[model samples]
Target: MGKATGFLEYTRINPKKRSPEERIRDWNEIRLPRDPEVVKTQGARCMNCGIPFCHSGVLLNGMASGCPLHNLIPEWNGLIYKGQWEEAYKRLTRTSPFPEFTSRVCPAPCEGACTEGHILESVTINSLEYEIIEKAFAEGWVVPRKGKATGRKIAIVGSGPAGLSAAYYLNTVGHEVTVYERSDRVGGLMMYGIPNMKLEKRIVERRFVLLKESGINFILNTEVGNDIPAQELVDQYDAVVLCAGATKARGLDVEGSQLKGVHYAVDFLGVNTKSLLDSNLQDGKFISAEGKNVIIIGGGDTGTDCVATSIRHGCKSVYQFEIMPEPPAQRIEESNPWPEWPKKLKVDYGQEEAISLSGKDPRNYLISTKKMAGNEKGEVKEVHTVEIAWVKNASGRMVPQEVPGTEKVWQADLVLLAMGFLGPEDRIADELKLDRDSRSNVKAEYEVFQTNLDKVFTAGDMRRGQSLIVWALQEGKLAAREVDKYLMGKSVIK
Candidate 1:
């Protein structure tokens, strides 16, 4: 707990961000660092609740209610309040392997679950975590950890958060870990799927350096099911943990979906990041929105990212379409009560930049794309859409009913689909003949993490479908524990 009256005495203060106008000029991280004294005060705002639901790590109404990794938020907050920097770092690293990643990208369900947030402003737990981890690195306190050799080997597919987490723990417990990634770089989505302004590539590279120093090997530009068969990994390593994320992006089904200028949001973000890192966008390898009117389908994080990226590319104009209705500005207490992830409207960095550039938010709510039109060259030129209302069907399930008079056409030179993912790809599962769930995710139970094959384990989006990075990190940790148990009959990972 923090000071007895700290919650009453201090108010929450978040870190500042670089002005959108200034940040859009480059791909650097947008968040500015908070002063040490200010961070301490923010930490002091944590209320010493009788029951801390910030670390409950439960699912509520299909959304994460608290820290999925069960981060010791209150303890770290108290430590930071006392200026015990090293102690806070230690407490944070106890459960969180990648505080840097989560602090930057996670929606921070812990804050929504914060007891103080029910009545007052919540503690800046996410900001405090970022400060602690960065300070830990600065003080040279963070280092690679390896245990006595257990003479076992683990092959992890995908270099995403889950795979990296499992590799960190498995290597720490003296197991030889080899990670396979189809991408040229480490940190699967973190490196590519996410844009650099949100999470700088150097930050991911820093962690990758530490992981390599800790004796984990990475095979780059090699597909597990293609380059080397899925069976080959199981035959070589004592255990195999699949962390390949849910990469099979859901595609549009309407007419003109095959237009040349239409692309997946994943490819748009990934190629932009890759080209930026490779040549600072000097190469024309990425899909450009420069001087073109863009239309983005689906309004999630990916859609938001597409909007920002299009703005940065100097797109003439951009619009994002969402099939779902817009959320309330404030959480509806009747339907979404305290301690559950707030179902409210959030203006993220992308929207902020777009609003700064254009005098209005670029998102369109309750709109569905009817079809697309292309020019003679077969590139996307226009998008047809209609407004719809959510009405109950005969079966009592809500469905979209089109509003007849709301038909509209939008000028669109490039169309990006950000409708999220269906599940993991089919190559590995088909080749290995692995069982799949109803959602087409790899059939691996939580905690156990073991698939039909005894040695074949799975985690992350590949197992749970599209989810937050915090959940992936936790799954990786738990899956590592399961692999350790299988290898040595017992594990000291926890």
Candidate 2:
């Protein structure tokens, strides 16, 4: 609201990205630095709508229309327009614990829900977010604050976005919180599953330092429910919060799934990220993507990551397959109104990289790999695929019916299955004898993170199945509140 005619005066501008010919040669962040004047001009595009739906952070009609974390978008945009970087960063951290991660990788539901999006391109909300936070880091305005010791001890099971957000909120409430991660570092998925090009590991480490200086404890390489039993945590702490993500990668049940050269996307990403961080490809300890023809199945973020990773590893060629039909390039049907997530075709970073490398898009929409053809030595060499079309049967449920005579075979030396996740692994649930939903996710109700057992709570993908990082953080906060309420007979966390 700093300038009434600001939105009309400035056309939408975005953060410049590294050139394709230069960026693909290495695994680094694509976003490049630009003048603060340009950022202010982009911020000037906010129309200052009366409703400010971008900050609502709720799902309407099964689609996220606003920021899931309910970010204060207008306030920060106005602050940025006024050149108040520190205040903007403070307002940003009020709701989002890790803007560096989300701003870099979030799908930007807030922008789609923006009123400006109806007429012109929406304000560059995501880039503004990234700038405000990154500037805060550069100026050293972001620092740690220790609580006044409430003498209450809490333990978080996983250190992903959910677990990290839970610890942040809980510690701010004057509780002694310690986070446990199975890996050698704090960030669970952000540390391993995500590649450095999209979200650099240094960003995670920077925040981890702040959390450590704030009196929050982090126990790395400590697996709860295995090294430290669940019962032990319950006995020691007043309440236990489980934020272990859904690590179980969904696998293809097709024939020859067991053949060599076939791998799970998460395993490939995790190992490759570690190897890249450890020695920058000097060691062959993990699965290498170098100089092989790669076929990635599934079209979500994970699949996109696979494509980018394969390309960075010097793969000869990369192909991504999606079972769903291609989305409309512009917008959803007219029936889907404003504030609903647009079901539109988006060229993510990976696809952009692939297109930059090749002359065309790498994704083959509405195609599925049916089977694998392997050589006599038991190594996968080719993949059999078929195109599909969705049609409503007599029962009215849309089903994927294959197109006859559309069967085709493609050569593939390496295949990575990036199909989403089924649910949280059942080992912890089976060990604790907790109830589960139909999807095998822990049976914990929304708004409250309580499990069937007393004083036991769940959050993040471990409870809600595979979901976005913002949702995971929100769930973690809500769950921590429920745990605090259960322990102290009152609740204050939000």
Q: Please report, in order, the local distance difference test score of every candidate based on alpha carbons.
A: 0.93, 0.87
Tens-digit lDDT string for candidate 1 (104-161): 9998999999999998878888888889999999999999998888889899999999
Model 2 Cα lDDT, one tens digit per residue, 274-376: 8888898779867777888899988889999999889888898999999998888788558577778878888888889889888899999989789998999
Number of clashing pairs, model 2?
0
Off by over 4 Å in 1: none
**lDDT accuracy of residue 136 in candidate 1:** 92
For all predicted structures, in order, the TM-scores are 0.99, 0.97
Pick the TM-score winner.
Answer: 1
Top lDDT: which candidate number? 1
Clashing pairs in 2: none
